[model samples]
Target: MKTNVAQLIELPKFLDKRGNLSFIEEFKHLPFKIERAYWVYDVPGGEVRGGHAYKDNQEFIVALSGSFDVLLDDGIEKKVFSLNRSYYGLYIPKGIWREISNFSTNSLALILASTSYNQEDYIYDYNYFRNYMHEKD
Candidate 1:
């Protein structure tokens, strides 16, 4: 598995006088099928979230309301992605550590996941995640 598989994806958008609309279809815009969806909202400024890595699940994160930054680490390198547009999203592949921070006021984060909630698939410790990556190599 490649370490730097994370990337930004743009969704289809239609502009109108009433308002703007964007839509994402599973397996069309994303590489994986969408099985679950959730959102994060009302996060305080400068707060951080998602200090873990998924073993099998993939995720796509979008800023539905405001702006925020996603820190991605592949155990050897790190990168930061800013999501401010509703039509754009960050696609996170499996086995990469992710942290969301630097949230703007009233930012809404919508996350589309490839799987349902599974506690056993998550690796929350940084040291353990590095070890897992090393084993994969």
Candidate 2:
């Protein structure tokens, strides 16, 4: 069983005095190899995203616009990330429960996943998730 762990993802910095431009390449910029990419937006404040954990999938998230939080829990320790920068990203390892909330209107949450969509890989129920983790012991 895997668990959520707090990790930092390095951001790409572009050099330009007048007009700067930075780009994030899926597998190149992020540490773990990426197999999928997705972004979240058009959300109202107070609306929360993410309440599930993956079996082996890892993710790296970024705030492309506005600001929001990346809340993580390893079924034990919890942490929050306030992302307002376009250049920074958060790395979320597998087995961790995650939530993206407190979106500041029109915020864009970009995510790079380590695996393609696999319904069976998702653990949506909290109790089941806990039980699954314990079963691994």
Cα lDDT of all candidates, in order? 0.92, 0.82
TM-score of each: 0.95, 0.87
Q: Candidate 2 — which residues are off by over 4 angstroms?
A: 1-4, 25-28
| Pairs in clash, predicted candidate 1 | none
RMSD of 1: 2.0
Tell how far residue 124 is off in model 1, in angstroms. Answer: 0.5
Instruction: List ranges where model 1 is wrong by over 4 Å.
Output: 1-4
Residue-wise C-alpha lDDT for candidate 1, range 64-116, written one tens digit per residue: 98899999999999999999999998999999999999888889999999999
Question: Model 2 Cα RMSD, Å?
Answer: 2.9
What's the CA error at residue 85 for candidate 1, in Å? Answer: 0.3
| Number of colliding residue pairs in each model | 0, 3
Q: Highest TM-score among the candidates is held by which one?
A: 1
lDDT of 1 at 135: 97
Residue 70, model 2: Cα distance from true site in angstroms:
1.2
Write the residue-wise lDDT of candidate 2 on 1-137 in tens digits. Answer: 12245576657778788865667775576656789999999987788999999989999888888999878887767899889888888888888888889999889988989999999999999888888877776
RMSD of each: 2.0, 2.9
